[model samples]
Structures are given as C-alpha cells and as structure tokens.
Target: MTQRIRELLDGAVADLEPGVSDPVAAVVRRGRAARRRSVLAAALVVALLGGGLAAGRQLVTTAREPAPAGPAELGRPPVPRVVGRTVVAGAMRLPIPDGWTAVENDPSRPCGDLHRTILLVVTGNRGCQNASVEVYGSERTYPGGTLVGDDLLDEDHRIVTPPVAMTLRGGEPAWMSESLEAADLAPDRYPEFAFWNVVTLPWSMVMLQLRDDGPAERKILDSIVTTPTEAGVLALPDSARSVSLTTPDAKGRNLPAGAARTKDQRTVAAVIALLRAQSDVVDDSAACADPGRPRAAVSLESATPTMVVITLGGGCQEAVSSAGGRVRLSDATLAQLKTLLGIGAR
Candidate 1:
C-alpha cells in the first residue's frame, strides 16, 4: 500500500517539476514526515489506553476553581477540558492535572464515553455494579433511568476486581465492587456505559473509575467532600418527635396525604412505650406481613430511628419492632389506642 501511494505521488510531483523544488526529494521528505506522524499517533493511543499513566502520574494542582469554558477539542460530544485545577464530581472535590478532564453525569445513562476522560458517577444504583469503571445512582434518583448497577457481567467486560472500602480526607465513606447480575444486554448492546464503581451516602453516592488504586487514583479519592443535600440524599422523617402514618389514596375517602401525622408529645411517648414492652405472645411475621387496612408506624428518632409496625382490628392484632419481639394488643388496648391517635377505618 505504501509503495503504490508513493509511486502515484512521485509521478504527480514529477509532472509538476517546474513548480516543485526537487520532486523526488520532496516525496521522500513527505513520506518520512507521514511515517513519523503515524508512529507518534500509535504511541499516543498506547500510552492513553495501555496503563493510564497510573504509575508516573505526578499531576497535582491547586489552581483556583475553573470557570466554565468552551470545548477543548472541536467535535461532537466535544472533549471536556480540565477547566480548573480542582474537579467537582458528584460529591468529591479533587485536584486535576493538566492533561486529564472529567466526563461527569448521573448513573441513568451508560458511562462508556471518552476513554481518555474520567467517568464521575453521582448517586448510586440500587444493587451491585458490573465493573465498567462505572456504576450509577438508582433509577428513582438519576435521570434517564436506563443504565444502572445491575446491568450485568456481559461479554463487553470479562474482568473482575475484588471490592474495597476507603475513606476520604474528611471521613466520607467510599466503595467499589464487581457485579454478576444478568444485564438485559445478555448478547447485545446498551447505550449507557458498559463499565462501573460504587459508593453510598445518606441519600446518594459518588464514584469514579480509577486507572488503579494507586496514588493517581488516591489523590481524587482522598479529597471527597459533600453534604447529604449535595449528594442528593432525601430528608429523613423525624420519628422521635412525631407519630406518623400513611394510607392509600382510596377512592371515596376524604383524607389527604400525610393525614396521619402528630407531634403530640404524650402520644409519641405512649406509642414508643407500647412498642418497647415485651410479651409472651409470639407474632408470626407471615401473618402480620399481609396486615390489611389500617396500619401504624411509630418511630423514635436519633442518629438511627427505631420503628414499630402495628395492625388494628386485623387477625394480627399486634405491634412489632426489631427491639421488641411481639406485643399483642388486647381489644380494650386497641380501642384506647385508636381513640388516642384518631386513626379510623379505611
């Protein structure tokens, strides 16, 4: 192929000899230049994909926050430029080097774009991740909802690395693991990324596909920073301060959403007290599992909430909790409790 191209170019150059300064020499110089370019291009690819510069990576910057800027390269899905010395991915704030940039997005879409850039995943998938240097937030959280952690261990990937846990400089938790779920793409293609990572926060999580768990990766991992709201965590219900219940939006009923909420101190204390009492009557979870109609939940809030579920008038006329095995409620007690909370029939 090279010989044929050279012969054609050499002839063309010879035909334009009058204008061409040393046609034979010119062809030779052009051929050499093209060869050098091809060699350099191949080398760049190998360096980018082969080892990710994970070993000799010494890029650590503390420049001011980057201002929004245009694409670094001109093309579709333009290359993300390292606009600042610092990067804000999901919940992490880490130093970025001169050559690299981040391609940030939620987990709802596949994360297989731009091998050269880091894939930052915020929020988390419902279950395990299929190690694609990426995992996603839950379907209920991130946009698009198509790509998630449970995608699968398909042919697009055949490697698995054991999961590990680590903490950032300030004490935020992080994690990563390989998945083995049956992705719907059993034998086909999916738009989202074919790779993954994992982490969990009070309401959401943040993750990055590391070139390796070495210093280059650690620099980013060590500087994670986020509040629960920043991580998109849902606010928790204050079970200790209030007694609350939810009911189906049944047709013909006049009740509204959150109709069963109370902050009455005595009522809250009474509900908590009843749940804490132990009884000889053992409750069958299977029987209580389908407790129909009226149900109640009373919580004692703290760093963690203690909650109890109750059945009113059903065969499973009892209240149960993790701390209290089973406290069967007598008919009189049930009636008194109903009067206290003002919960009515469906």
Candidate 2:
C-alpha cells in the first residue's frame, strides 16, 4: 500500500510543470507549521504548572501565620488621663483614683465585731492580680505609739518590713507596714501593705491596706483626703441657735416637756467637747430607726426654721436628719450625746 501511494504521488507531480508546482517549497511550509504547534503546546503546559505553584505557596503561608489578638487577650483596660475624683463615703468626702471602682460590703454577710464605721474598698482592672485598696475604721481603741510593733504583732501578723512613720493630710501621725500574712478577716493568706492613721476624735483607728506596692497603689494612697470630725462641723460660726435632747417616755411617746434644752454657752461648749472626744461623722443611714419613732432625738435649731438638724438614735444605730440627707452618726458620737442629755445607755 505504501508503494502504491508513492507511485500515485509521483504520477501527480510528473503531470504538473516543474516551475508551476514546487515540491521543495511545500515541504518547507509543513516543517514550519509543526515547529509552531510544538512551541504552543509547551507554553500551555508551563502556564498551568506556574498557576498551581502560586496557589500552593499561598496556602502554606496562611497555615504558618497566627491569629490576631482580641480585646480580652490584650489584658487590662485603658487608664483614663485624669487620675482622681472626690467622692462622698459616708459623711467624709474622699478622693479616689479615676479608674478604680468602689466595692461596698454586702449587708447580708455577717460582720461580727468588725466596726467598719467608714469602710471604702476600691479595685481596678490594671493587669495586677488581686490588687485592692481598703480604708476602714474599727470601734476598738488602738494605742498611740508604733502600730505595727504593738497592734499588728500582737495579732500574730508577720511583718515583712519595718513600719515607716508618715503624716496624713491633716498632720495626723500614721504608720505604714508591709506584711506577709493576711488580716483576720481576709479569705486567703496573701502579702499586703497597710497604712494606719491614729485619730483621737473618734477614739478609734483608721487604716488603708493595699495588696501591691506598685505606682498605681501609691497614687491612690496620695489622693486620700482628711475628713472633718463632728466637732469641726459644729464649731463653724453660728452652727446652731439652740441644742436640745429629747427621749421617749414609758409609753414610747417623745416627752417634749421632759426634754432638756440648753442655750447656755458653757453647756454648749461642754457638749461640743464631749462629741469631739468620740467618733467622727459617719454615714448611718443603713442602721437608723424609723424617723417617726426614734429612741432618742437631739435637735439643733438654727436661725432659719428649715435649717434644723435632728439626730435620731436607736441603740448603736443613729442617723442625722439634715437638709442634705439622713446619714448615720458614729457610735461613740451618739453614745456621748446620750450621756450629756441624761438619756440612759441602751
């Protein structure tokens, strides 16, 4: 069959004129066409291989990288530019750090023998673990001298460092100590530093305790404000025109006629002195008796009829009803006032 096709091709070529049909030209054209086809096939294969390589590289890079951080993973909340703000805690106004939040004692929890007359606990979310500032006062009397050596040591608290003498805002003597053991009331044993300010007015001791001795803690301690005593409030010029003490009779009725009213300068001075020796002003709203049926009443009349200051008492609980609001009085302050008025102790 090959021989027969060759003979046929030769016969067809022989029939044509040599100059009209050129076999060499036709052979060269076919050769160029085959080379072009081969080049086009190779180019298509290379294009496909390069695309696969690029996609594989992208997948590998993505698997090796880490996920971005979220808000919680960043740790602490941002601190505000301003540092402190004055806030009223009980009767005393104090300055607290800006980002810190106040945590009040839970009323439902039992506080046995813990005379927290003015308690303020503050905490902040600044990356420090278990950091807090606690300011409180106890009803028990603390000796004037070295608090860390005398009081804390007696209580079995292991003092990690020596106490440093310092002065509070009003020139009151204070002692600071760092300890390894926790307080009697603490839930856990943790290292702590404390500042004890000895005050005579209330015959009680005030304390500020911090978990960590960091710069943030120091800033908060520096912002503390000295609160005015009850005597200071009463000593203001023209505090009251007259002061009276009233108590309930056998029938639980307030005896106006039997009440003692004192306008004498000497008696007023004595009463003021007595109050100054006792507890400082504190918020007593939570412990006050009913406004209508108080156990005892100490009324201070001013020139203006509306400016009357009435202090109602029921046992250790006492509230001062004034224009601002009804607030609790310190225990010692109420007790001393009762003694001066000839009202028997509860």
Winner by lDDT: 1
Q: Residue 103: error of model 2 in Å? A: 40
Question: Which stretch of 10 consecutive residues in model 2 shows the poorest summed lDDT?
Answer: 21-30
RMSD of each: 29.4, 43.9
TM-score of each: 0.28, 0.25
lDDT (Cα, tens digit) per residue for candidate 2, span 1-346: 3353334335433433211111110000011222343434323332432221110011111111121122112221111111245433222234655555554333444543222122232222112122255444321111111111122222222111112222234322233332112132133322342222222111112334444433434454455543322222222112344455654456644433334655544444444344333334433222223223334444444432111123343443433322212333565555455555545633
Report the lDDT tens digits of candidate 1 across residue range 120-234: 3332221222222332221111010011112112211111111222334433333323111213222233334432223322122222444332333344454555321111111
Candidate 1 regions exceeding 4 Å error are 1-239, 245-254, 257-259, 278-280, 283-288, 291-294, 322-324, 342-346
Q: Would you give me the overall lDDT of model 1? A: 0.32
Candidate 2 wrongly placed segments (more than 4 Å) = 1-239, 276-287, 291-293, 304-316, 321-346
